[model samples]
Target: MIIQLHGRRHLLDVDLDIDIEEFTSHVLFGPSGSGKTTLLRVLAGLDPLDEGELRVDGKVWTQGSAIKVPARKRDIGLLFQDHALFPNMSVEENVAYGIPRAKRGDKRGIIQWALTQARAQGFTSRPVASLSGGEAQRIAFARALARQPRMLLLDEPLSALDTPTRESLRNDLRLLIHTSGIPTISVTHDRTEALVLADQVVVLINGTVHQIAHPSTVFEQPADAQVAAAVGVETASAGSIVRRTNGLAEVEVEGARVFAPEPSFSTNGVLVCVRAEDIALAKEQSVTSQRNQLMGVVTRISPHGSLMRVDIDAGWNIASFITRTALDELELRQGSTVVAAFKAPSVHLIPHD
Candidate 1:
């Protein structure tokens, strides 16, 4: 399906053209207040566009001041951050409530099918109040499926749960949505979620579309500096290509030399982008195959989820993510000296104009 949406909302001025393959998941990803949810809501018909047009599959859904189709007739199922299940209702009742009046004739069949699809059939008779966060989310998903929507809009589907529960539900949700054959658009600020759930990722920042590509491309080869920062390229610095040999380019950033694959573009200025996870920390300079090694002092160390984010300063700032075990073994501290090593291929160079 093809969607062309152009409009303005509170803190949002968007112009997007998207093509979604049938049964594939598209992710709207960006930092907070980047208008990810706003775009999703507009597409769901929850809000009106100030001045623009929305067309789906060559059909106009909205014009400058007119809405051709209202929210109820859009055939979309939306799941919010909160599951929004009724506390007084049973799991079965909650799922049944989402069934349209036309489909209530086969209520039992529809409910059972949706619950089974969402893997929530076992809790059909359980009280909503007694269910866990993950269970409640599953019930909400089951309800959404009962509608048999042509499109699904999920706004932070797993954000309300704890880390472990979120991770587990993320996997289940991806499989359920794909197998159900429903095209989905999910909004998230979590990089891991975008990487795992999205067949295509739309990176929005400050209410603008910065990049649209596969998750790997968006994270590994950002289109520009804004997308690099939005997608969390932890170690990015302004540099210039000082020399090129064979297929390798040597870049200089604040007196520090970094080697990377040559860019296809003909340019001397570049922005070196490297993920924190790609950098390796060592207590001593070891002879390895890594093409780039910088001797730096540990400036700071902070907890990053299950890992540690170590900040170093060789001639410029750099960051690396390492496990706690490695931190302790390396004896890293605020003043410890260490070697940061990364292969040349790990460095992604974006042409800077």
Candidate 2:
């Protein structure tokens, strides 16, 4: 099934235009209140579009001129952030709720399949209140899948759980979605989750779709400063393309000139972006294979799980993540002067708006 959306939700101030493909998943990613859930509701026909249209496999659900179908008639599977399970209903009955009237005759068999698919069949007769958070989540997923809808909508499906459970459930959810061959649109504030589950990623911010691209492309080459921050690219500096020659461009930031591969657009008033992992640090200036090197003083040191994040002020702030052992051996700390080096290809230049 294919989904095409072209409309504006005035309350959220978001205009939508997207073509979701068959057997693929797209992640709508942003921070809280970015309108991710509102867009999902629009797709499920729960929210009205003030203008434009929405089509599923060529069947019109809504248009600027008319509302073609109601929410009940739209075959959509939606799993809310809270799961929205029936507290009074048993596991079997909750799954059966999503099944249409035509499928009611074989509801028992279908519900069983859904429960098994979601790994919730073991609690088939359990009351909703008795199930654990993860168990409830599985039941909710089972209920959504019971409808065999044209598409699936998920709103922060695992955000309510703790770290370990969330990680485990994320894996299970990915496996189930892949196994069932359902087209899905999942909303999340976590970029890592978006990276894990998305075939295509739509970066939304301030009720607008900022950038839409493949995960690798979005992570490596963000469309703008907002996108850079959204994808966790923090080592960014404002500059202009001072010069361009031989497929390379020189960007001047905070009195220092840096070189990077030229971008498609002219890079005047641009932001030079590089990931923390791409930078290497040394106590003294040295040149090996790295294309660019600059000296700076360590401004901050923080622990990031197993790695140590070191921030250097090379005229401007540049961050590097290195092993704790290496940091100790190098005798690096706040106020220590060091050299930060990275390849020209590692720097991505985006035109500043």
Candidate 3:
């Protein structure tokens, strides 16, 4: 399905032209209040169009000469963050509600099949309130899938659950949704979720799309510094490409020379990006196998559950993640002189905007 939005605005001018072709799953990712949910609502026919067009499978859903289809007749199943299940209804009844009344005789079989697909068959008779967080989420998915809609619209569907439960349900939901063979458009603020579940990712900011591409490409090669920073890669100080050698280039960052591998930027002014986890900490600089090395001092340390984030003060501030065991073994502390080593290939050169 291809979706094109032309000259549409709500409080701001939103002239977007997006093309999604044969994509079974897509993720609309952005920070809070970036219009991710608003875009989804517009696609689902829940929100009135100001001025634009939306087409699904070449069928005009919204346009100048065409009347918009009502939400109920759009053949789209929506799953919200809250699940929106009736508290008084049993799991089976909740799943069966979306089915046609004349086909009620097949509701039991359909409900059982849906539950099996969701791996919640044992909770068929339980009240919606009695189900655990994961169970309730699975039931909600089953209910949405029971209708056999042409497309699925999920608005931050797993955001309400706890971390562990959310992770588990993410895997389960991916499998179930793909097996149903319905194109899905999921809106989420979590980058990790978008990386794991989305086949294609669209980044929206302030009602505008910043970039749209595969997860790997987006992380490895961001469109600009804003996109790079959004994906957790720290921006480096402004520098000029001093020298270009055999598949490696040297740049001067604030009077300090840093080496990067085969950067695309040959101009004088450019910005670089390196992920925190890509940097390695060492007690001393070695000349053996490692290429890129810099001397820095540990300025701050933050705990990220299993990993520790160490902030280094070099020519430019750089962040690196290390295990707690490494932190204790090295006796790392503030003001300690540490060697920050990273692969030349890991440094990404992004065009400054």
Candidate 4:
């Protein structure tokens, strides 16, 4: 299905166009209050487009001041962050809620199939309140799938769980979404969630569509400083292209030169973007295949989840993530001198205005 939407609603000023192929997933990704959920609601026909139009498969669902189709008729399977199950209902009953009364018997097999596909079949007879968070979410997913809607809409479906539960469910959710053979549009503010679930990512920021591309492209080669900041590209330094040879460009950032694959756009000045996780640190100038190595003093060390973020002032500021074990082994401390090394391809340059 071809979906096109151009409109303004609340804080959202969106112009979105995409094709929904079978078994594909598109993620709307951004920070909080960026209108990701707003756009999803618009597509689901819950929020009318205040000033424009939304067309699905060339059929108008909303135009100017009217919603041609109501939310109930959209045939969309929606899964919310909270999993909104009925506490009094058994897992089986919750999954059967959307089926028509006349056809409930005919759809029983489908309910069982969905429960099996979601890995929630074992607990079908249990009350919703008795299920764990992960199990409850699985039941919710089964309920969404049981209806066999044309497309699925997930609004931060896994965000409410604890870290371990959320991480474990990520893979399961992706697998089930694909297994259902339904195109999906999911909204997420978490970067890793977008990376894990998105075939295409629409990067929204402050009510505008900043960049729309694959997850890798959105994270690695952000279109502008706004996108770079939003996607957590930790190191960005303004640099000038000093030379171009054999498709590689030499960029000078604060008197330090680094080789990078030439950017597609022709610009003398570019923003050098390096992900902290892509950098490697060494106490000495070790001989390795990495093309860029700059020596500097470690200015700060901060805990980042299971790793430490080591900030180095190597002409320009550079951040490298190392495990706690490596941190202890390397003896990295504030004011420790170290060499930061990273591959040439790891440097993504955005054209500077």
Best model per lDDT = 1
Clashing pairs in 2: none
In order of TM-score, best first, we have: 4, 2, 1, 3
For each candidate in the order shown, give its overall lDDT on alpha carbons: 0.89, 0.85, 0.79, 0.89
Q: Model 4: per-residue lDDT, tens digit, 150-183?
A: 8899999998899999999998888888888899
* Count of clashes in candidate 2: 0
- Scored by lDDT, model 2 comes in at 0.85
For all predicted structures, in order, the TM-scores are 0.92, 0.93, 0.91, 0.95
* lDDT tens digits, residue span 76-189, model 3: 889988888889887888999898677678888888887887788887777788888788878888888888877889999899999999998888778877888788989998
Error of 2 at 34 (Å): 1.1
**Error at 240, model 4, angstroms:** 1.9
- Provide the clash count, candidate 4: 0
Error of 2 at 229 (Å): 1.8
**Model 2 per-residue lDDT tens digits across residues 163-226:** 8989988878888888777888899999778888888999988778888899889898999898
Ten consecutive residues with minimal summed lDDT in candidate 4?
99-108
Error of 2 at 10 (Å): 4.1
How far does residue 308 in candidate 4 sit from its true spot (Å)? 1.2
Evaluate residue 329 in candidate 3 and report its C-alpha lDDT on the 0 to 100 scale. Answer: 83
Q: Of 2 and 3, which scores higher on lDDT?
A: 2
What would the TM-score be for candidate 2 when compared with the true structure? 0.93
Better by lDDT, candidate 4 or 3? 4
C-alpha RMSD (angstroms) for model 1: 2.1
Clash pairs detected, candidate 1: none
